[model samples]
Target: MPAVVVVGGQWGDEGKGRIVDLLARKARVVARYSAGNNAGHTIVNELGEFKLHLVPAGIFYPEKTCVIGNGVAIDPEVLLGEISQLASREIDTSKLAVSERAQVVMPWHRLIDRLDEERRGANAIGTTGKGIGPCFTDKVARRGIRIVDLMEPEDLLARMRSVVDYQNAVITGVYGEKPIDFDACFAQYQEYGQRLRPFVQDTQALITEALRSGEHVLLEGAQGSLLDLDHGTYEYVTSSVPSSTAGGATLGVGIGPTDVQRAIGVFKSYCTRVGNGPLPTELFGEIGDRLRDHGKEFGRGEYGTTTGRPRRIGW
Candidate 1:
């Protein structure tokens, strides 16, 4: 009951990452609760500017324990690459932990994501093609491969093959795309398992231990409250709730809603949304241009870290 949640007050890109990075100084544990690589957190610190997708922004603080919680769908390649990048900069990432219960974003998931989005055509959801939705779909459908599945060779192979077979059928039959090669996918993940095993653990227990010991915990939310699957714009929202207002952080991290003692909503001077959605207050033309210019959305800028598309800014 001593957790603090930092959530996006708008349609994401509300500077939640910077807030979490600053607040993490007072927290012993910082945990990401929802979304995946589809969501982005661009943190500019003394070391450098790091655009975080999966790893918690709290990783900057060597003293804090950062966790990829159960609510997160992990893309191993992205996460591993991010870790390598950080390590290259002399950043200490040994304190990070990946939840055993977190969903895995497999190769098929990424493939199907792009294929399906292309099929949508005019109705495309403007996805980052990072497979966040598909990975969560498998999680809800009970066909997900968890982090623990990667630990044991037999379990990993069996689970990966089962899901791959079904997904491969959809990929070829429905999307008319090439099916994911099971052997190749399996081999790649086998290497990923070896590299990721050290960070995999019972993150729920770790968080509980930190809480029970009276250590301050920070729960970081991704996307935004208005993009919540159940609460936001239908068909336009994210696949999961990434806000503490809807108890997403608790559910994502395997904790109770009551455990969060405070929730800080981060907001910008203006509203901005990245993906497809009905943004009524959305601005365009000169005002929008100036907003983008001031926010540095132009050039090699920080408009949409996940999609690299210009954000729809408004009042």
Candidate 2:
């Protein structure tokens, strides 16, 4: 009858996935409320190991509905690959749904991300270059393509044409890089559109109706409070605020704050941070190495599930 939220108490890589997976047993729905492919949640059971980037941990339960809420930025390529990977293992993803209002990650977003990082040079913020920041930028700029637009070819093309021209100009005229081939992007996206159409829907309504029916829900969060764009480490934070509090949880899922019945914060014995950031207490050199080797954790060791980089350790 209420939704529960799982948030990271530290700088992420905190085991929120396993907690959500365990909680999904009682939840009728599990929804991912923010971020994009840049976030990863791994789950291990009798079905072997899985590193999920976009899909919710609840997908392991066939009876539970998994929703990617409106606050997320989706890379169709990554989502499709995950869907295929799950299918290969005889896992059913038919219960997964994407919000019609969710933003789409375009080819140019990745290209711009790399260029922007290069421009930062020595000051580079160590982004994953997965098109996350750029996609969200376009979303805020009102130039983003939504799931509803993606499933409709004619409208998608009309939008892509203008956005591509503008982005290519930024690449060539601003960054002095080659333009993204419009035709190739269109062709690939057209295929993606068809493949993803089945999962696109008015997810806000779906979530609302589920709540109305007195079903329990789980709102899964990505990143951590320390990586939140508005509140985390400046210039090195994620595009979204992944905290489970007020604006953090409900704003993304299109729900009211009162809908959340609990907020579960996941923490570890030590602090771990991925990407570039100021870790004042971080161990370096041999000391860092020894602690890292000691980390044969959760089928992923102590490395980041998203970046595969050895997580910086601190206590």
Q: Judged by TM-score, which candidate is best?
A: 2
Specify the poorest-scoring 10-residue window by lDDT in model 2.
239-248
Backbone clash pairs for candidate 2 read: none
lDDT of 1 by residue, 231-252 (tens): 7776888875344343788888
Give a tens-digit lDDT track for model 2, residues 2-21: 78888888788888888998
Best by lDDT: 2
Worst 10 residues of 1 by lDDT: 293-302
Error of 1 at 5 (Å): 0.5
TM-score of each: 0.96, 0.97
Full-model lDDT, candidate 1 = 0.86
**What does candidate 2 score in Cα RMSD to the true structure?**
1.4
